[model samples]
Target: MGAQHDKMEVGDLKQEANRASPVNIIVSPDGMMYDYLNLPGRVIINEEVGASGESLSTRKPVKIEKLYEYVSALRSNSFKFLLREYEELCEISPQCPQTVGLSEINQSKNRYGNIVPFDHSRVRLKPMMGKESDYINANFIPGYKNARAYIASQAPLPMTVNDHWRMIWQQRICIIVMITGLVERGRRKCELYWPKPGFPIKYGLVEVTNIKEEVRLDYLVRILRVKIGREKSPKSRHPILIHCSAGVGRTGTYVAIDRLIQEIQAKHRNVDIFNTVYDIRKSRSMMVQTVRQYMFIYDFHLDAWQIEGDPEGFKNRKMVERQKELDSKYKELTSKDDLMVEQKATYDLYELFLMAACCCCPFLFDKN
Candidate 1:
């Protein structure tokens, strides 16, 4: 009798499963019932009803494997969408250059080492050897007919030798207005002067410590005004060249700000500054590195609220203040005279090392 009853119970369960929507049921190996429902492609599994005329006492554990499978499917769909979108974007706006980087360099081992030839076709590759003079003397290449170039000295180094690389690589621009000890050294050693002949390098050598909200704003304003003015004319000037050291992080931020300002002026729309930066980085590799720098940009846009205020009142005042305070302390630490001197000496050594290394291995200088 008990065996008959068990058979009847199993038969009823099977009937129940068959009667329910094919999409909404899963019978586990342990005979635990799971009622699966599709919630916009995401699966929600509920426990089976109990024999006691009550819901199941135990909660239905999530099927992690099934969840991952569903997520993977969604991601695949998203990637396809993005690919289609990218293709359409390329077709519609061929003028917008795709981001390129140093990783594109060949990695095959040679007798000396991995040798990478400089590719001038790359949007981001800047020749290390060629001065502005060299570019002017050379005949215009097909695509580079409207090309221009500029160079800026890197910031002062940190207290230690290891820190020097960080300072030179991470510092944004060497502004003439606020000269760092490092900039001064670069000017002396490399004969690096502002506005080198045949090039219109902006001469505003700001110290590493002085790259504050005001400094960024000032630089952005200057670049945008120049770009806007030139764009107005029929015989407009060449594309403005902006660089720092490694052509990432700070350089990316500056470029992002420039592009944002341009877009704002053109569209008359207030853009999410953080989102703009994020988008730029997504399109390029290692564009912005530090979370601190990212927060600085966010704070800068937020502080603008004191004067103009957020029209929508969406700015997070508390978070902005916290970041500003942290950045302020960083600036204070960097501005000490002894530290500044140390930083300068370190940067000088790095520049010498870089120049020497590049000479020995020409491929090291190849940015493409």
Candidate 2:
């Protein structure tokens, strides 16, 4: 009788906690429950709840009206919220071993011994010149929609330059986003892999030429023309190579910000920094490596919301009109096809349009 009484007390406490909890628990038909911190959204299939229960992966429009309200509330305690989230992420983030990257045969291929890619997700180069081993210190990172949208790699060392180009050529990568200098603070962070503008250099059989470079106040954009033997590099939605000295710090931060920007533009309402970092770290450990970097992601999103969330700020602008047109078209396309694949394609196209705008008109975007 005493044991039964104790069980009843335990059940009562759990019920009380659930009632008092601020989070909303969403249970799908399959009995899978998803919890969000005060996030409210319309119920859908629920099998495909997105970063903040937005259901971006589905064709049907997921209600995100409450996300703006949540963001406003978050803004009131942004720093404190992010700090607590970061601490929690550090404790729960999963990681894998760098077995192959640290193997004796491939040790020299890594720029830093401690900063190696997970064996499971590392990019594998084709065996060349009769060499049996294929290795590079890089991992495939997922983008907002694409699973293999970006490659996070350590900056190339002197010996591994050829391998870097080989991976790029093999992967048919169109974009290369480097976030480090050749040297920093009296330390060599990366080796110069690209030729001078208008000059061509051959790394192994791959010929790379920097066709043009545009220098801005804060960032420089380079257009590269690459060729491999008889075939010229074709443009496609291939994985972009993004590297920093350690590959996880600035690389991760840049990728996170890029993904979040796409999310904000796509949904136009919600932003989930904690899950973004958590998801990226699962792919490549230690992504957004520092607390300051994590905070920067939040800062960037808040700044972006100021512009993107303001309908009046972009009134009478072509970008806004285009956005509205896309929204209408996206709804039409989703209604007709009713397939996830089609929905994904439309989402990717929308994200590409926003990225192109940011690239073409840096003045329009606040680079802070």
Candidate 3:
């Protein structure tokens, strides 16, 4: 009886061991460990498992590679998504004017023939007319023996009211003014400080940062605030032209922040930021490119002090830290190499990972 009992106990122990063994170490499509069998004296394997357990660790390296590939794929998918959003936005925005013509005025009977009046309230034009004798009397005709001769000499180029209007409109008045750099020409003119000669108009330079440094962020905020002063007021007519190298990621981010501020001030709910940015990109092709930029919009929304003592402060700080860590890691991985090489490798790796991820699971890359 004791021998039979011992045989039964051994069988039970074997069954327990079988239950405890890891079930093929199921790894997620993203290369993360999903579960581990709970058994006594059973060896557990993970990504940190080294080469010594190579036979038993069929999954670790494969999972790590999959993880890298998955990240790359995610980045590529994000870029593609941004491109699609930009294309859609561009379809809904205004386009720049294509042509201007002014060559037919000399031969026309009417002085202002075919010339359209400036419809904008800010501009005006006037014409003048004088007789041939008046022109001769004023000594306006050159190289003439007498008044009549002078009058006849100037007859070919008939001076009319239309001619005077065209001259005044085209030559006497300056419509467009160009200023160099961030300082506006008008602002320079109004202030006591004299601007250097030939200073060009300045456009805002868009900058990207995962960690929001107070000084830089404050400067950007101040700039936007100054530009958007007393919304729709006549004091500021200048459009704030802002661009980064490609005029997308950073540019879109600033615009998003600006829009968010406005929405919050207006006390509007249901602010669809993605749609707002999408609308902007419709007019501006290179709007938002990077996932970091997209994520920045979320950060901007959450970090904004719309309400005093918002409880999200702690959560936002944690997210910000995570973002900084991710950015640092990405920078480290892609850094220490030539820019062209890095971009190409990053892009290629991203594509491959995306392909692999999509193959593994359809919805793996669709999480917001």
Candidate 4:
């Protein structure tokens, strides 16, 4: 009776193990990978095909050898799941002290009441003679090595223009990367804190002179007396100030890209973006606010890899087309849909990614 019971127990354990097994992955004939997620609907093979109606090879070029692993990780079935996991972690993570930012004296300085910097990471400006408070709605977001590498701040309000310039002057900030315009969708997103080109504006004791303005297809560059560079110079030692409307979403995205660029340049591989954004969120709440922004980091990193791989500028026609496609995708993500219905949109993207993962190399997704 004991021997029979042991055999039955072993059989039950095997059944349980089978139930816990991962989904079956298969490789398509066209070199694409696919993950059979066992969804009720039929598998819709949405892929980019050539003129001959054959699926284009999804393999990475030898030039981007280092990115092979990274690319595989992005295309894995688990990638989206990991993104979702990290996002949930961000919600439940231990928060730093925000008492100073929430205090009555500093309440009016914040652009959005809820989006305040933690006391430990907040930037402190020199207290002016008349103004007793040395507070700014900004936090010191760390980079690869520097703890105070970047100052993530909210867009300046009309009332806080002087405080903005004061923080800039006190920090000796060289570059100001403004990610939003003065207005968006008939709403005032940020205040014009700088003077017009060829004009000098004095905010508090600091004078900002706009020397030149260069307009491009998508963005405009303004040459200001406050120089922009990350050299070892004393003037450039201060953290580079980056701000958007609320300062978390776009600022965090840009900061992540900056950190990844540095990492890729130094090592060319082993880049962990999940952990990168995780650390950023630890410093400030909702840094990379949405999954769309998180996906944009992947897109930007892929583009960077391509550009870096082919230093000779000998990209094929397919590469150029891919670049254009990424650019179009960037524009779409920046639209109002990203702000509204983001949860739905992100899940929709996850579904598409899972489909693509089914068509990719299974070895890349292998845990071993």
For all predicted structures, in order, the TM-scores are 0.31, 0.65, 0.30, 0.66
Show how many residue pairs clash in every candidate, following the order shown.
Answer: 8, 0, 11, 8
| Candidates' C-alpha lDDT | 0.28, 0.60, 0.28, 0.58
lDDT of 2 at 295: 51
Q: Which residue pairs clash in candidate 4?
A: 32-359, 33-358, 33-359, 33-360, 34-358, 34-359, 34-360, 35-358
Candidate 1: stretches off by over 4 Å: 1-235, 265-268, 282-284, 310-368
lDDT of 4 by residue, 1-368 (tens): 00001111101111121233332222222221211221233322223333335443323221245344444443344343323333344545447889998999889888887789988888888776575577889999998878888899999999899888778777877667777767764667889888887877777766777777876433456766642233221343567888878888778877886776565555545455666777887788778765556766666555555544553343653544765664465344233333333232333322322332312211011000
Task: Please provide, for model 1 over 1-368, each residue's C-alpha lDDT reduced to its tens digit, 9 standing for 90 to 100.
Answer: 00001111111223222233222223333332211111123322233433334442211221222222222221232122212222222222212232221232322111112111123322222222233111110011111122222221122222112222222222221222112222432332112222222344322211122112222211211111111223221222233333333233344444444444344434443434444544443333333333323333333333322223333433444533544564454343233343333233323322322333321221111110
Decide which is better by lDDT, 1 or 4. 4
Once fitted onto the true fold, the runs of candidate 4 whose alpha carbons sit more than 4 angstroms away are: 1-89, 226-235, 310-320, 327-368
**TM-score rank order:** 4, 2, 1, 3
Local lDDT at 105 for model 3? 35
Best of the candidates, TM-score: 4
Candidates 2 and 4 compared: the better one by lDDT is 2
Task: Give lDDT tens digits, candidate 3, residues 195-298.
Answer: 12333221121111122212221121111111112222133222233322223344445455455444543543333455655545433333444433444454
Q: Which candidate, 2 or 4, has the higher TM-score?
A: 4
